[model samples]
Target: MRIVVADDSFLLREGLQLLLAEAGHDVVASVADGPAFVAAMREHRPDVGIVDVRMPPSHTDEGLRAAVDVRREWPAARLMVLSQYVEVSYAEELLAAGEGGVGYLLKDRVSDLDDFLAGLSAVAQGGTALDPLVVRQLMARRPDPLAGLTPREREVLALMAEGRSNTAIAAAMVVTPGAVEKHTQRIFAKLGLLAGDDAAHRRVLAVVRYLRAAGG
Candidate 1:
């Protein structure tokens, strides 16, 4: 996969480039700060973009805002945010922007290199890869939207937010696919997602609802 690495830290930018190169992916552009990241993204249009939440000049949300801009310009852009802090509002905004190939992972929580690579691959393939910590923070911040769900239903919802398919969720839970489907239906129904909604639409809707409930 061709990629772009964007971060304010020189070491991190080089480290990610090296890691991606060793993993058989091309780092087409390595940039520091947000505007350059956006320019590189427009020029390279990489398969996936890895970015930190903060960047130079502001050290606030430059990279995140850049990701939003990139997504706005190219709706199909695949982006994965690597940040030390959750930055809840923008993270929610990023997730709610669109459904395809989006991820937000905490830098410290990514202890397993293989798992991190797998998550990146998942996002590049138009799937989600929400970090469990991010999910937990969102859930902890809001309780009203998910009030109707049972514990089991909530478990299924969390996995759904992580972009896991029913088969994968079933394997993780050691349950059958049919059982996973039933739980998913229950989740959708409780979340007010109509049965007539397309499956993928409903799934993303359900996950977005969880994120939207997370207060800014």
Candidate 2:
């Protein structure tokens, strides 16, 4: 599979290129930051991308997010996010896009060449892979807010945070206007949200919650 690497560390960047090359995969581009990663992907059009979760600028979820944007526009591309720390939250977002053709693993797991290669192969072939450590952390959580919701409800909330009103959310969710109102009420109650409280002004807080909350 043709691949691209995005990591701020030069050693890790170069090492990955050499290792993937040794495995007979082309390393089309190597970038040191999130913006550069995006540009490289557009320039090279690699089949798969390997990126560190925290790279450059905020050192937050830039890499993971860029991958998501790429996936939205290029549905066929495979993505794998690597991080040194065993963080469950990152894994959740990486898998949130879709289970197929995606992966999230701790960087330490790369030491096991056979196993690491297996993960790359899985993603390249439209399969899913998650580091065991990540799975363990995720299992510790009980209750999923997303569970048991109608597909329309899920889509509603996805755009709801964009500050859409009941009518707008209704249009986006493709349900009856009355149904959208009911679904929003259900979502607000389920998510512990309160209305008439100026919570709408907390959009940034909501963004971080969507991006950083552990099992939220």
Candidate 3:
């Protein structure tokens, strides 16, 4: 897959280029700041863009804003945002764009190269990939919002918020896909999310509700 990387830190940018290149993915562009990142996106139109949430100048959400702009201009654009901190608001803003072709992961998670690549691939393939730590942080913030959920339902919901598919969640929870589906239905029911034919859309709505309830 063709990829573009954007980060203000020269070391991290070079490291990412090397890592992706060694992994057999083409690093079409590597940029340092948000504007340059946006330009690279327009020029390369890569299969996926990996970017740091903070970059250049103010170093406060510039890369994230650029990512959002690119998504608006090209809804099919796939992006994975990396951040040093677990910023739930940033995650919410990125996910608010809707389902698929998006990811939000903490920089520390990159040490697990296999997981990182998996998330990048998932985003490239029009799927969601959220960091587990981000989900955990959000869950810890608003206990009252989820008080109505059973423990099992909360587990399913947390996995769902992490952008896992039913099959993946089922495997993680050590249950059948059918059981996972039942838990998902219960989650939506309790959260008051409307049932619909478009499962992906409903999934996004569920995640948004989860974030909002968590005070994000």
Using TM-score as the measure, the top candidate is: 1
lDDT of 3 by residue, 1-216 (tens): 999999999999999999998999999999999999899999999999999989879988889888988887877788999998866666656666745688889998899999899889878977777898887776677664778789898888788877788999999989999999998888888877778646666676677677667764
Off by over 4 Å in 1: 165-178, 188-202
Candidate 3 has its poorest 10 consecutive residues by lDDT at 90-99
Q: For residues 1-216, write the lDDT of model 1, one tens digit per residue.
A: 999999989998898888889999999999998999889989999999999999989898889999999988888899999998888777777887766588899897456778788889978977778988888877677664667889888889889888788998999999999999999999899888899888877887788777777653
Report the alpha-carbon TM-score of model 1 versus the true structure. Answer: 0.85
- Candidate 3 — which pairs collide? none
Rate residue 202 of model 3 by lDDT: 68
For all candidates in order, the CA lDDT equals 0.86, 0.68, 0.84
Off by over 4 Å in 2: 86-90, 144-216
Greater-TM-score candidate between 1 and 3: 1
Query: What does candidate 1 score in Cα RMSD to the true structure?
Result: 2.6
In model 3, where do residues sit more than 4 Å from their true spots?
139-151, 185-205, 212-216
**lDDT of candidate model 1 versus the reference:** 0.86
lDDT per residue as tens, model 2, 1-216: 899899998999999999999999999899998878878887888877898988878888778778777777666678888987655655665555542567778888889988788788867766555665664475456443456556666566545433345676677657778987777666566555667544433322332233234355
Better of 1 and 2 by TM-score: 1
| Candidate 2 positional error at 177, Å | 50
